[model samples]
Target: MMNPFELERYFARWEFTAPFLLSASDTEPLAMSELLRLASPEMSDAWANLSLGYTESTGHPLLRQAIADLYTQTASDEGGEPPHAISSDDVLVFSCAEEAIYVSMRALLKPGDHVVCLWPSYQSLYDVARSIGADVTLVELREEAGWAVSASEIEYAIQKNTRLVIINAPHNPTGSMPDHDTWRTIVKTVEGSGAILFTDEVYRLLEHGDAVPLNAAATSSPRAISLGSVSKAFGLAGVRIGWIATRDAAIFRSLETYKDYTTICASAPAEILAIIALTNWSSIVSGQEAIVTANLKLWEAFMSDHESLFRWVRPTGGSVGFPQWLGEGSVDEFAENAVQEAGVMVLPSSVFRHGNPRVAMTNNFRVGLGRKSFPTALDRLGSHVRARYG
Candidate 1:
């Protein structure tokens, strides 16, 4: 049996009950009506006459095409040729990104296989590989190093048995993203080792400031797989739509077969909504980015005012960031008290524990930077910090 997912379990207990979910990774979600309003005439008509029957296991054709367009657009921006463009056949939809991870790992790994993955990440990234009896080497990103990924570090971790290398950009919990050259090095390293590169791009298109989104890995390497979802960047978490894009036919067939045992298809309405969101990708993502930009300033001011109590490697991308606790007690205690007394829910580093004792993350807690409610949440947290830490 697989181990319990601590991060999700914590949120399961507090997410709906908490007054302020200060550690949520997704942007403020869009309402159904708001999303519907953005749909094209063709999609509107499809929604009006939608069937509630089970969808094709491969996903809706139009939905797959729309998702494929996302990769193609990014490829084109990078001066890619037609061969680099992702087609609908290269995209396979999953019930959620979590399912995509689970199914993909199941398909690609076996006993004695070696996997390399990032730490303080979504647990499913590594845990599923372990459950399959694969040996996993975690390349831990350090807070002292600004939570950065070192290509050399990853290069050293590769073993002859390594079959997979996983990386999440606009990383969860910390919001640390690698520079373009570093990303290229990582891709090259994984490719040279003959390992499949599985990049979690769920937070793609949410880059802050002048940072442009990286070209989809599926577009650049036949051995690379890019995972994405409407949950984070598009702010449609409730829809439960996510997909994997890859140019590798053999692995694509394996993932497709493995999916047969899980959710055969996604919800019909959710698929329709996802198509609408992807079709208007720019406007939807821009709105989410606007929230992050505004809330980032609020977070900066809060951090500045309470500089003695916390320190963080300011996040350059994504909607969430990790901040270290500089107070007298454990961050776990502080997080518990914050929710019970301050009505703010912040995730402690304990929730990200992956059974690797070498990584000491007790000093950190996650804070989300994309919510419209972030300002109020930060105020509540600030008040609590002063009352307790002082």
Candidate 2:
């Protein structure tokens, strides 16, 4: 039986009803009016005259070209080859990054295949492989070391039959990022083991400040594939447009074929919106970065004030944070109480637990520094902790 994503399972139950939601990975989503202001007037006119029919399953050519350009831009920003390039044909657009992940994993995995994944990641990385009856090995990130991953740990997990390895960099929950050196080591490890690397870079562009992101993983090896989306960094979740960008023609063809069983193509309207979003990318990213910066400041002050109750290695990139419950019972129980009693909802790390015997299940919870309501949610959380556990 296939295991469903626990986070989505939790959200399906409480997301709509929860009064204080602090667990979302996305920064505050942009409204259509704000999006229009960022885009050119011609884009609005295009929306007005949009056709309501099936577009190319590979994606609209213009949309694909814009995404290819972004990968080129990412390569340049991350200090890669001056001739950095990926063709629009190398990209396969999907409904969302989550679907991109599923499509990639499903296309690559087979019965009896062996897969290794970075632990405490977005569940689909490991669970999807497991659900396919593949042997899934998880290598844990060092939590106390600011989510640092050692090459030895990853190398140790690799086996002769290892078919795939996945990494969600600028990672989820913890928001920690790896340096260029780490990326090289990881690439070397996977290459040596002869396993394809699947890099999830959906959160890569959300990096705040001057910290440069690693080059797209697809560029590291012919077998490697990278995923990107318009949701997180650009705050355009409504568009629900995401893609798989790769240098390998075989991988691109495989996923594109598998995508037929899934959502055949993105909506016509969303494709137009995605094209407009990418066309106006700089302004969209900058606007969301400003929101992330302000929210981070508030999160910092709240954690500092409640030192006895919370402690964290502040994030270096992305908007999610994992904070320890300093004075508490089970953090899972505390989080539920906060939601029900204080109307504050923060994700307890329990939901992300992978059965890796090497890693101790943490008593930490994901604290999202993405929403404008973060301060009020923190306030309610602090008050509840003081009353219940202080």
Candidate 3:
């Protein structure tokens, strides 16, 4: 199988640092000690008793049940279709969300299948689809429209042979999210076309403003699959817990079958740690939110001053946002110069496959708000841009 190196992966290999950067990265992950310390006092002893062995292929029952609870729409006691009400049978936990995505792509797609994916997205979605010999089409989001993709564009991109439509809400580089109306249009389009929708909701919880609540696609249609994890939103990438939720029994079965050849099951310790994290999810999430909120303030202040050299559509959700350089030279030249002169790293927009010259000439780049002292970094970056372009 001949597959090209994903654009983002290739750029990520060349590292540089600066403030006002956007990349599919996060602040330092939550310390495991901090999580373990949050364990119930009674459970502290139980932690010592954890047996190290191969976890159940599906997932630990407690972990699965906890995850299912997140989808329940109403409070458990109120009994309004528990967030999503998917049975444990419908869930398959993996080493990480990436693994869940990989297995799903491998299992559900065949050579020559067609896939529609959002552009400037997490590269894996398109790369893996292509690796499977699926003809992938990218639906480009408009920068002028807060990087939102139109439903009509998606409809036009769909063909009778298109088997899947992949999307990431609170998207990676742009942090743009569709409103309820747009989402309705997208879901309706997918339903009408009978294409399986793969929704990556790993960053769903990081919305910066009032976010429209959308259920996992798995809950809405038999053809939708939702990918989720504790990494981005919860700051627990180390736990490596991610899952595929779908009401489609065929997809569920196929994924399980393919997993036998890949990772048979997730690690036992990781599962236990994940359960603890979920149990204390409210606190953990709140802590991360506080960090994001503070960092955003700093970002806003920094951007306000450098309006001439930078153009940014403030992210509506997630930790990262893409802001254009709007400079006279290439993003690489600017990025390389910034790294050498400022000792900070920022991802060039070209890295995300906006195309090479687009990467170079285009001013767009990604920034992560989770970094320590991000404000300081942005300040340093602004100085560099002013020195060069101003």
Candidate 4:
């Protein structure tokens, strides 16, 4: 049986009700009008003339082309190799990134195969594999180590029967990205072991400061899969558009077939909006980056002021950061109190507990810096912490 999704359940209970939500991972969302304004003349016409009928099961042709363009481009300026350009045929659209993860896992993994996953991940990364009867090993990202990905540990974890290796860059919860050398080493390791690599890249292109974005994994290897969504970086969660890109023709076909069993096709309107957002990708992402950059500065000051109550390792990328709680009570109790007393919702580490018995949970909690309201939320949390902890 598939395990419960505790993180989402916690959000279901508190996300709407909380007065100050400091645990959201996506960048601030855009209004429909704002998004439309960003659309090209051709896309605007498509949206204006859009039919409400079912979309192509694969995806809108234009949307697939736009998504293919994303992976075709490389970040060689960031010191990575030029990607092997992928065409529309290499892209597969899903209703959401969660669906993409589910469909891909169901199609690629089988009973008794070994899988290695990064710890404190979005649960579905490993859980779906387990649901299919695959053996999983979670390599932990420790708070003491600033939550860095350990290529050596990942290499060590792979076994002869390993079929898949999963990793999230600009990782959820922690927001730490691996250095280029480390990332390359991991890709090469998985390639040598004959295991397919699945990289969660929803948080790509949101790297802050001196941190540069890594090349898309699909560009690196034929068997590698790159998962992307407009929710996090483009703030289009309401549209529910996401996709998977790969150079492996067989895996692409497998994912396409499995998608038929679930949401056979994406929402017609969502695909139109996603095309606009992705077509104007640079500008939309720039807006999000501005908000994240400004909010991160506020968090820096807040963390400095309350350094005694939390062990903070500043996140290099993404909108979320996991900090170790140093207060007298457990983080669960503290988070509960924050919600009840301050109407602030924070994700305690318990929500991220790994299914593996050998992997221990930490005292960390996630804080989000992506939304425009983050500064105000930080103020509320800071006041609450000082009033209660001091």
Candidate 5:
């Protein structure tokens, strides 16, 4: 048998951790101790008296209810919809967002299926889909338009065998969020294609402007599966709790059955902590927003001064931004030389599978302004880009 392992091996080479990342996407993780301290007065006695054990496979009711509150139509006052109106029956909590992505892809896709994904995305979507024998197509984001995707382009890409369309909004690298009209067009495009739309809303709560609340494709259509996690906006990656919310009973049932084979259930302590965090979500989100806002101002100023060598499309929302390197020489060469010589780590766009010239077409680099060292790091990057290209 021809082994497929070699093709899959490269996916493991990249690491998104400290010292390797100039734009560490998950570095601004929520402090568990701070959350615990906030909840101490209410649960110190009870938490100390609780037992450690396997939690409900679907998730503890309190945590599920807390998560449900985030959805607009699921609020209690919207009597047309009950508090837990959406299907929580099959909500399977995973260790983290990555696990949920893995399980969901494995359960949903088969070999030779066709999947359409946005380019310069989180690598897992592209690599995982490819690893499973799916024909993956990369739809490029418009650099001129702030890395946004158009519905017409999506419609044009659909093939007879297209089985799934995946999107990350408050997008990772570009931080682009589609307007309501754009989303409506997207939903219409995928509605009857027999293809499911997997929308990753992990950074939904971190909107930089007057962005709308997170939209679960599941709520708007029967073919959408929405993924949310406590990691990004809530800064609680340590809790390792992420869930899929869908109104599609069939998907719910299928993923529930699929869950039994993977994690089986979430940890009790994590669930409890997640529930507590959700209960005070507003406060937690506000604090994070403050940090993002402060750092963004600093980033904006840096980008403004370096327009000749680097160009940026200010992110509408999310913690990161992708700025293109318009240098005179090779983008990858610039990045490699800069990192080796400068000891600064910024992801080259090529890793996102966008090709490079002496200038990488995916020649953009991500800037995560949330880190405390981000300002200094940006200064380092600016100096390097100017020295090489300016």
Candidate 6:
């Protein structure tokens, strides 16, 4: 049987037709011209004579090293440190973070395998694994507990034959993240169980304010795989270069074969741009963070003004968060009608919520704080919420 149809696309279907999109997962994207503005003279010179030839299926050597370097900084930025734990050889670039998830699932899972994943995850996390014939279990995050996962619950969810464990932090929708202590607990749990961990870390670079970023790349167990890319943090979604880092030589080898059957290689020019983006990573991200920080104030004021109609657990990091929309009628209908009447697009929680009734979240919606137009978008969203719910 085929995998279940993705539910987020229900809201996304109107993306092009809608006037304002507040649910986008990426920050404001950079135009090639804007990207050129960040490039050094040497990088600019390289782009001038760019080649269109097919690149290595895994990734360019320089680009791979750049990704490895980011993880190195992730740990040491808090203090002085040495080389990154995961080497460039562990990196395998993909066309986008989405593609990396797909190829990893395809190459690794077998029929009848058991998988444990976080609830309210990007649908691909569980759906794709389920499609491969794995029996999936979801370990939910408690919204009352600041949207953090329970390591004990995770231990309870896995079956004896559980083959994989998935962790997504700076999580999508609610944007929950495990603090460093909690993360280490999870790592020990997964490692103890001897299950391969597939970490969706696409949002890793979006940390702000007291957000202690964890390094899945520094996983001591050779079984953990980290997924990351330039889309969210660097606002280069159009470039579509992402990668998976695994110290496991076998996993990397298998992914290479699976990738060849699919995208084979990222676009050559995207690789060139990715290198330039990384070369100036701190500058690019700091500017993006400033936009998010400012927009967050707008989010704070709007939420404070409309607490009767909506409420949310503020995200620690990343572009998106899940917020409860306490409207009177069916939330699905409200979402649809809002698009028709208000010209705003946001993803309802049903797209992400998966678990039992007690824990299954409803009446919530996902919104992005990273857009340049979020101030205007917030106004549109407020008008709709007031008219429809109040």
RMSD of each: 1.7, 2.0, 3.3, 1.4, 4.2, 2.5
lDDT over C-alpha atoms for residue 382 of model 3? 72
Q: Evaluate residue 135 in candidate 4 and report its C-alpha lDDT on the 0 to 100 scale.
A: 98
**Per-prediction TM-score to the true structure, in the order listed:** 0.97, 0.95, 0.90, 0.97, 0.86, 0.94
Q: Candidate 6 — worst ten consecutive residues by lDDT sum?
A: 75-84
lDDT per model, in order?
0.90, 0.82, 0.77, 0.90, 0.73, 0.82
| Alpha-carbon deviation at 261 in model 1, angstroms | 0.4
lDDT of 6: 0.82
For residues 211-239, what per-residue lDDT tens digits would candidate 2 score against the true structure?
A: 87788888677778888998888777878
lDDT of 1 by residue, 1-390 (tens): 677888999999999999988998999899999999999999999999999999999899999999998776655343323337889999999999999999999999999999999988999999999999999999999988999999999999999999999999989988999887787788889989999999999998888999877777787678899999999999999999999999999999999999999998889999999999999998999999999999988888888988998889999889999998888788988899999999999999988889554556758999988788988988888899889887
Q: Candidate 6 has which clashing residue pairs, if any?
A: 173-321, 173-322
Cand. 1 Cα-lDDT: 0.90
Question: What is the C-alpha lDDT profile of model 6 across 35-74, one tens digit per residue?
Answer: 8888788778878988889998889887999988877766
Per-residue CA lDDT of candidate 3, range 124-169, in tens?
Answer: 7888888788999999887887798689999999999999999898
Q: Pick out the ten consecutive residues of candidate 3 with the lowest summed lDDT.
A: 73-82
Q: Which residue pairs in model 5 clash with each other?
A: 30-235, 330-358, 356-360, 360-363
For candidate 3, what is the lDDT? 0.77
Candidate 4, residue 316: how far the Cα is off, in Å: 1.1
Clashes of each: 0, 0, 20, 0, 4, 2
